[model samples]
Target chain A: MNMKKEKQSGCGRSEDLVTYLYGEATPVESSDFERHLKACAECRDELTAFQSVRGTLRQWEMETVPPRIDIAIKPTFWQTVKELFAMTPVWGKLAFGGVGALALLALFNVSVTVGGGGVTFSAGWRPQPVQVVTPGTVPPVVNPVTPVTVRTTDEAAVRAIVAQLVRESEKRQAEQLDAKLVSLTSKLDNRQRAEFVKAVSQLKQDQRLHLASLIQENSRRGGPDLLDLIGQVQSASVEVEE
Target chain B: MQTLETTDMQLVEQTLGGEPDAFGVLVRRWERPIYSLAYRMIGSDEDARDVCQETFISAFRNLKSFRGESKFSSWLYRIAINCCHSRQRKQPQPDVSIDEQIEEYGLEPMDSRESVDDRLYRDQRAQLVRRALAALPHDMRQVIVMKEYEGLKFHEIAEVLGIPVSTVKTRLYTGLTYMRKRLEHVSDSL
Candidate 1:
């Protein structure tokens, strides 16, 4: 239709066509354009074509049911924490890391005293002097120059403790020996029962072989021993079934 | 206050104020339009979905830069446009062109209808329109899709694209003329 007028004498109204078509133009602009529309068949035709295109455009629509779009939004706290690390400056991260490490060290410094022993630590804990427990049989050394960390052992206490430990060891060894003897006896009983079953099975097998041999030999010899051989075979078959 | 009826600005404020689900609320509000925009712009469902996802992520990342100067949706549309542009540059075309898609899906019925022929006719028209839209230049295509399909106003489209409203009108008009010619030609051929 624009070819019909060949650009409407360079009407310079092309841009307004979309605005007017979309009803975005003001009423004054609409009235003026309406005057122009009455005279310009080119604009009218083009506008008509555009309006039809808009109708045709409706054919390509978004799915009636809106599609599910996945855009991750983590939990508030998690996002904050993530952004805290991500958005933080290097110096800020370093400062935070330093404080975190120190706080962790201080928290770990809390020690529980067990049996007067220092908790195992390498950083700031000092080793305390532990009193030596021993039997007091010998006289204490009188070395004035010795360090305070060293203390004399009680020989009598040491002897009594050693004797008690020896007696406990002997009792424990006796208990272990009793347990071992019971286990061995149980194993021996099982083996003996198994051997008895094996011997009985062997005897049955030998009896069956002897009966079959008797049947074969009697059949060759005569009919007199036939009843005895038959009796023996029946007894062997009964034993096998049993 | 942060219900479904909350304004986009309020939700943006909540999101910026460290309310994470508020951003989720925003995503739910705008993802469909953004997807539609990207889909029409790039003509690929998968890439359009990708563009939709990246648009929100970039918006969330750059929420501070939003500054409330324009509408939050304008800001979101701006991100979506940038994503679609970069995506288009990276791929230069859809994963499958309109012809390939038509060949594959056979203009399947878009919705439940009374008769098969009506559905078929409607779907063919849609397919022709999609091919026309996809064949248009990117600048004209974005303007037309934003205006006709997504229903963004002229000023809103201008704001999102960082262009003047008159340019949007001209591009939209030219784009529609091209589509009219293309659709006519295709129908004549058929």
Candidate 2:
């Protein structure tokens, strides 16, 4: 028994004999552990206990299965693009490219229209009126020598012509006003622009009052006939102006 | 070198060669032990299943990078251990109340005394073991789980965890000693 005890102690190192009992020991360690277990009651009891613990642990099982996963393959850059294109049907590819081409074409059409400064509309058969600016109608070119005012002979005809001319002049004036406002806002210093805006606002208020007074005076004198004609003319002129 | 001899390089090579089914065979071979290790470590069936899935998925993704430096099972065990670590870190601290812990660990309470009392007692002892296992520190628990459930050698566990074999032995001894004491404590309480 003394020899057997010595043999057991020598064969299995108690340090990791527990691991050996669980079958985790190396082959050499397993051999020694088996030899040691046969001879020593103490070591053999320890092994049995460790084995029981291990057996109990083995009874524990996970109740569920893991989820399945597909590993994504990393494709080359060109292969990625190729795969993207491949995923698209032929008609879809054509549609994508076609939409891009259509966008470019629309952009080109807009550029051409902007460069020409006006849109051309076809009337199917007859050409619509294309108004030409008569030199007499255009404001004198801001030169000192050019007359600011001019005279006409036939009062009614002159009034009608002047009304037509005034309507045309006001339309041009409105376009110039828009352009001037844009330019002034962009170019003028802030203080100067503010002052200019105040002056222009005051002038518009004064002009509106003057026009109202004139309309009142004409209604008093002409018994609303002149006012009615002026109203009709103004309505007609607005449609043409637009 | 011995690890290289045991590593599943052949299986991996076969897997990479369009034999995806080869991996399923590997799964079938390792699943029970892997699942057992996960279940023992986490003490929750749901979390253990998650760890097992993540382990295989990670192993599959990094299969190409495995250079046969260690055994495939060791590598797989390492992945599973790391997964369990992360899972534990994410979990809120479990209630230390014995009843709560027992219930959370899936231990059913004993009812009327029956002829199956012996089997029930054994099951309760297993649950007690599991509680003791869960009570251990993360480092020691890892060594015990791998050694007991996964059956990794001291050197192999050390290799998987990248720790010294002596440290592994120390932890195993400490863990087992703790288990014995805890088991005795539970028995006395009953």
Candidate 3:
């Protein structure tokens, strides 16, 4: 009964049985455990059982081959860039996000023009209303609520001044065009006259040469140059005979 | 090259010195033992393979953190064990069904030339042993596997597990005792 209790609830001696079974006990520990084992059937049986268990466990041979393990110590630079962007602080992300959003708004043609219309914010687009003024009436430039009407005399005077300015502008443009046309025409006439004079002089020179040749031919044929004419005929006849 | 490659510490230094192939040398050297350790601990070929991969990757990533206090193998075993624990936490497998116990441990069909009876008997006994080991508590199983299968010394197991040597021996004893009872029961059933 005492042995059973010691076996069931051991002192630190149980661990020695393990150390001894696995052969890890020191020589002194081994000799002491051996002495103890000679007396203790429990330790001996337990040692035997554990050895049997280890034997059974060792029978499991794993024939499975290990697959090759490759570690990429350095990730791709693109992945590094992604990690860098991912490490951005929340405020930085939000700031960049805001900038990106503004860029998107700009891409969508959302324009904010500060005009007399008190800041026009158009999404797609809305054209401003067009106004027409009669001949005697001077309307406001862009105001619809209040029309600043001028007296007839002022309106007429402004109209008269505008018409006068328009007439002066037209007259200046017409005069400029007329002077250009006249100068061009004069240049064309001078060029034509020079060409015509050259052509006439050339024609007269040719006519004079022809008349002199005619006269020389006439002189050779009958008028005091019969010797040259007889030589020409005789040379022609000799060539014909040869 | 064999003469030049002296030790794990040398490989580690070479790896740290921007020679990545040196790490490859280390991986090739240790992959099998680490894989075996993982397989024995988890009892699954596929998960063990994953654990092996994760262990090496973790080691390579944190190679600078290794203090050289333990053997490089012990340090690697520590990482592999941690990865197994993490994987267990992430995905707890269902208990091996009694009908599927043979399939669980057989892993691959081996020895086509053996008589059906002999193969069946051998595979059945192996499967029973595996079932028992699988049933062991994780801590005890870890100790048993390190001591019995991996042949790690008691102190090495202790160093890897970061436990006292007494604890390791105690765990080994308890684990072996439990395995004995389980095997006895299995033998009786057979």
**Tens-digit lDDT track of model 2 for A1-242:** 11111112233465757556556678988887688778778777666665555555554443345334333445457756666888999999999899988786655542221112233222222223222334568743644575343221123343455577789999999999999999887776675656544543544444446546656877787655433444544565457559
Error at B90, model 1, angstroms: 1.7
Worst 10 residues of 2 chain B by lDDT: B106-115
What tens digits encode model 1's per-residue C-alpha lDDT throughout A73-188?
Answer: 66666666877798999999999999998887766553333221223223333434434444565645655696444212233344555777899999999999999999999998
lDDT of 3 by residue, A1-242 (tens): 11111122154587788888888889999999999988888777887777777767766778477788877777557756666779999998899889989988867647565432344455543333334465677854765577554432244445566777889999999999999999999998887667645533543444446445645887777654433434444455457569
Evaluated at residue A118, the lDDT of candidate 3 is 43
Least accurate 10 contiguous residues by lDDT in model 3 chain B: B106-115
Instruction: Rank candidates by DockQ, best first.
Output: 3, 1, 2
Best by TM-score: 1
Among incorrect, acceptable, medium and high, the docking class of model 1 is acceptable
lDDT of 1 at A219: 78
Order of candidates by TM-score, top first? 1, 3, 2
RMSD of each: 31.9, 27.2, 22.6
DockQ of 3: 0.25
DockQ score, prediction 2: 0.07
Error of 1 at A18 (Å): 1.4
Q: Candidate 2 — which residues are off by over 4 angstroms? A: A1-242, B1-7, B17-24, B94-123, B185-190
State the lDDT of candidate 2 residue by residue for B59-134, as single tens digits. Answer: 9888888888888888888999999999888885563643445456644334436427776655666666767678
